[model samples]
Target: MSITTLERPAAENDGDGDDGTGSGVGTDAARATVAGGEAPAAPTRIPSKEGVEVGPRRRLRESTLDERFNILGALVAGPTVATLLFGWFTPLTGPIGWVVVAFLAFIGFYILLVSLRSDREEVKDRVLTVLLISAGTILFGALAFVVVYAVGRGSVALPHLNFFTQTMELAGPLDGLDVGGISHAIVGTLIQISIALAITIPLGITTAVFLNEIGGKFARFVRTISDAMTALPSIVAGLFVYAAIIQLITHQRSGFAASLAISVMMLPIIIRASDVVLRLVPGNLREASYALGSTRWRTVWSVVLPTARSGLVTAVILGTARGIGETSPVLLTSGITAVMNLNPFSGPMISLPLQVFDFVKSPEPNIIARGFGTAAVLILLVLLLFVIARLIGGKGPGQLSDRQRRRVAQQSVDDLQRIAARNHLLTPSPAPTTQESSP
Candidate 1:
């Protein structure tokens, strides 16, 4: 055997070994044979553990709840320990100040700990997440505190059934809680808000529609004015109505005047918000309506409005909430009255906000309690309005209730049957070709 033939069998045997050691030598021999020349160079393998190939170690996966708990515990415990140790040396004053210090310490410790295990990018992400969660918790905690405080303080007056049924007319500032109620204030609030809504809803919605649907120089001017009016102060609105309508036109401060002032505050909000909502309506819907030969008014009425109904309702509720809580305008326009005035045209009215303001100013504890109660009622009323709006607005455009769905299906079937009947009537019947058919 030649020298090459003697070595070829050894190379083949090495290639057939269970270990991957001789892979490069066998590959080189095969390439040499294919080239019909000297053998190619053998690649060298770096020494590894027990002569076996090894790779970089992968970080362990932490998929269990326990792993997560440990991480969170570390993040919390490290900062707490540091805060306590530091506080032992120094001193913290307010609870708020302590919280701020603890938060800062926690951020520093958390970033340091995370950086030890995680990459820079992951550390940044975790830190941001903690910050956002902390911010949200703080915000919600403050809101919850306010609500709890209001409810706790107001509970004293809320237990009396007479508070809902009677009026403050008979009750003196120092009277016991059982003797008087906020009925007059409630009634006045309802009436004033009702009048405001009646005036604002139509005008605001129309203005929004005009701004969105009609694009003229005048429309642009109106939009600009509306945008500017959104920031117009509540006191300014009250003053405007006081000067223009109350002083110049009506020469009286009545619930009507209050309603006008509220309308002034509410209109800009409703118009601006509704305009935003209406603009969000898809252009495809309008195009489809036009394809079906619908006029601009019909498209707006049937397609655009229906599609944006829920959003428009939200806009209205937001505006109402804004106007309802306003004190200055109601105070300026509606002179305070303890007796209920059901009529809006002639007499002064007291809304819950104004009533609360009035009550809290007195030195009497009972009156202050009543003010808190009225504030709680105002909050409840706002929540109630939101619920009512949700119910009335129902679902969005493509979403329908069971009854609505059934009605639409039935109407569709009826239309199809009617169209078939009309086509039957329009078609000419076969003439007298019976003899030719027989043949």
Candidate 2:
């Protein structure tokens, strides 16, 4: 007769050789012994161990309640302690000294508070964050001071309508702020910078394209030359134009000569900046263009330039800013002229910077006020230029305008219609059956 034994579940096995959380190996051995076959030699199994330990959960970016309390305490203590030390014990005087000491105390207190709870790495991270924030605040504060100072001193001259309309050609040195304006310098600056941009934009972008698209030993040489020239002194550019163009070609100081000098300074900046921008264009884009059998020049014009247009505009803006503020080059090449000279090729022109320099040279208080006003105007002009440049070329890659979107939609429709027509024409027609009576 055959026999079958019902073994107990491993949950009942206690202090047995199969020791890993009731795996039931003891029950299997018992069943095997009950069967009519010789029992198999006992197999060894390594007990499973849960050895992995999860570390404490913490967030790097988020601030804890304890951290917030620490910061608040430090802020209050830093200023209070610094004031007491300065007022009662130390010889420190002035707002600047108080602020300096307070900031130092703030840092020290913050470190101590943070160290109480956080480990070394966490303390270091919090300290670095405070330092970075303080540095940024100081930088912004200095910028604000400059802007506020300039605008405040110049505000006296900005109220009058005549300040925007009239020129210094008629007004004397001792005249009131309303009587004279930087109109001549404004017009002269516009013309000179327009000419300079005209010269620089084409040459700069072309040179940048050459460096990226058609690179060779000559391209490397050009890049090196551009790098060297980026740091070239403005005075040297002025002298170069002073000798080469003013002395030889124009034979006099003129707005045209000033523009040449400005272009010399601007060109290298544009090329180097543009090259960096172009290098950021993805290699995949160029390869795709090539895959479509596009010529190198065509691919650059359509694919690369459009993709990096905004960055190129930024490069141009940097060059423009650098060239516009240049006093020495404009002074050396254009010379000063009080009257409006629209013709750049023949006569002298005075830009905003040069005009400011001229105004400050006069010891009269009114003239000094005019100088400040001119500086304010320059700042406003620069801001306006930035706005216009951004408007012109601010679109990022793959972002299309409404017109472009409509055009793409129309193209897709046309392609679909054409594909449908081709499919219909290519369809096989059924063979005509022979007429065989009623068969």
Candidate 3:
């Protein structure tokens, strides 16, 4: 049999040396068709550039000049019209009523303005954005009001340095702010919270780990119990401690009892929060560790814990905040004391919340000021705790601080050196290099 060689047509494929479609499959198929082989590929249609923009595309999210004008106009006109309706025509009285009407009118005007020049989607988007901004403003305003109101009212007491140093043990209800301090309450709070944290952290984290890593029917039962405990009232926790530990065992209210009650409130919160954080650890991390011959516990300790450290700290902060601010539990479990009680197990203890409660009960202005001052102190303490926790474990997964990055780089260098040393030990004489090392 004689062989036949396939060749390309001269005119059809000058630009691409194939089909002008810029595909080699077309050329291969043509040769195949000539030699009685595969079918030719379908020709591709090139896209038209008739109306396509070569300039930088406009960003959809950037606000137009019209939108800004509309917003400004609506803000001015809506409130103006609302003020007229309230003041000129309507019998509506009070700044609050006027403000509410003005806000409603503003929303209406905003939507009307946005709808005037934009599509239904853009109008909806603008309305949603305004609603969100309004919500954020309300939340921020409420927070600021609470903080300002507390600190402002307390400012009279806060300036006195002795307010943080002296205790109410020697001071009477009619005594001046200079006579009494919350030092005992502050110390007691520290002790109670430290104890509660000690008990809560290990048990909560272990329970959470059990729920996530070693789950079973028992874990589900535990989770359900934890969920129920989250809704448990502070009074109930105090009563539980009072009934079981005080009446049966200790026979008196003390900081330890208060701590136990706080732990009851904190445990569920920490467990539930920690469980969520631990669940977010990727499954592949476990698999990777196991593939490298790590035990389940070892993998969880090294891989899972490190990965979820930041979230775990957040969980702890939530629990701490919850437990620290609880008044009812501490009140019922820890009988209030004016004198500092360092021994958590022995005598009655008072915390900032309890001190505030006691101070407010008295009708004296000095006592009231002390109450507000104590509350402000509690807020500051919580804020300090939050700041510390954030500093320690604020970084999310795959995020490293400058210090951490440097540490990691150093560790990598150490690992490389160790690996090289091991290779040298295993095989005494070094093998010839494929290429000389760069200086």
Candidate 4:
């Protein structure tokens, strides 16, 4: 190969050296070629030294407007003006209306969350996501307050023993009417919820398993329809049950009708919840079971279900809670009677929620108070169901065995000892080393 020495260009010695490190030879060759009246070929790029930069890179700065005050001030002003104008045009209904409006206002405030503003932007998205959570708490607290206030006011009319044992005999004196109890409503609620469980549990779990585990295109379609069914109104469900059984068979309300209606309403919720929980189970568990020679159904029943049992229990509890409070469906499907009836297959039944509706609608103040008592009982029952669900999930303190606890304690002690030994070794200790102790 012919050798030729190329002279470096003036530009190569310039300040651009800081920008074009490691490419000095290429720059020199290009300069010599240009000097020889030939077009300079493309310069070869030398890999720059890693992590060393000679100069700061240029950056573009964007201009932004300050609209925090103006935007928020406008948001407040618009609502205020509208509320004033509308209140003038159509009178405000009172505290209830204001509370509802405040709730709606908080929804708007919630929408402002997840909104981005650049550094130069003056808008402050002041954690409106927290508003959604706070609004939910406020709504629930307000509800609780209203119930407590109503109960406190109504308790004066509620006779002491009458709240528990007697049936509503709407005859005789008003004092006699006060002699009735919620035993019938309590029995009805339990029977109805039980029947609903019997109808929903197996079918819902099977359907959920099929959809989540073995589902194909058709199963997916069925799941989609089931999800849609969850949103169906309770009254509509009652009407469907009425049309299916009452209109075709008896043309009358009964406990069976109520149970069927409640089951229909509950099925979608159970399936959806169970399906989601089952889907959440790690695939590895299922594979492990199968690898150990377990069949598909056995794998599901033993491994998959157990792994996701806690969530499934929660799903069942939630479904029970939803069905327990259903008034419209039970009202349409089961005739409400004050007397206690236990047979779900035969006879009219009365649930707590339906009784509350009937009792509250009655002209009698004592009946209204009884309605509040029923509501309180229903709330307590739902809360109890939650507690039971948590317990059944094996999260109870009693779930820990003595041996397991002892093991845990021993492990903790060992860890502490290890830590202490490590610290002693790290420190300049006068104590003999392990080698010295070995002798």
Candidate 2 — which residues are off by over 4 angstroms? Answer: 1-62, 401-407, 417-439
Candidate 3 C-alpha lDDT tens digits along 55-148: 3335668888988988898889878987898789887788888778888888998898888888999899889998899999999999999999
Q: Where in model 3 is the C-alpha error above 4 Å?
A: 1-61, 421-439
What TM-score do all the candidates reach, one by one? 0.79, 0.80, 0.82, 0.63
Give Cα-based local distance difference scores for all models.
Answer: 0.84, 0.87, 0.88, 0.73
Clashes of each: 0, 0, 0, 1
Sort by TM-score, top down from the best: 3, 2, 1, 4
Q: Candidate 2, which ten residues in sequence have the lowest lDDT sum?
A: 47-56
- For candidate 3, the per-residue lDDT at 300 reads 88
lDDT agreement of model 2 with the native: 0.87
> For residues 1-439, what per-residue lDDT tens digits would candidate 2 score against the true structure?
5311123233433555432333445556777888966666544433324331112234568878898998898899889988998899888789988898888888899999999987999999999989999899999999888778878877888787777787888899878886878888999999999999999999999999999999999999999999999989999999999999977887899999999999999999999999999999999999999999999999999999999999999999999999999999998999898888899998899999999899889999888878888889998998899899988995888888898799999999999999999999999989999988885
**Model 4 lDDT tens row, 212-294:** 77879999898989999999999999999989998898677788899999999899999999999988888988889889999
The collision pairs in model 4 are 166-181
Candidate 4 — what's its lDDT?
0.73
lDDT of 3 at 413: 100
Ranking by lDDT: 3, 2, 1, 4
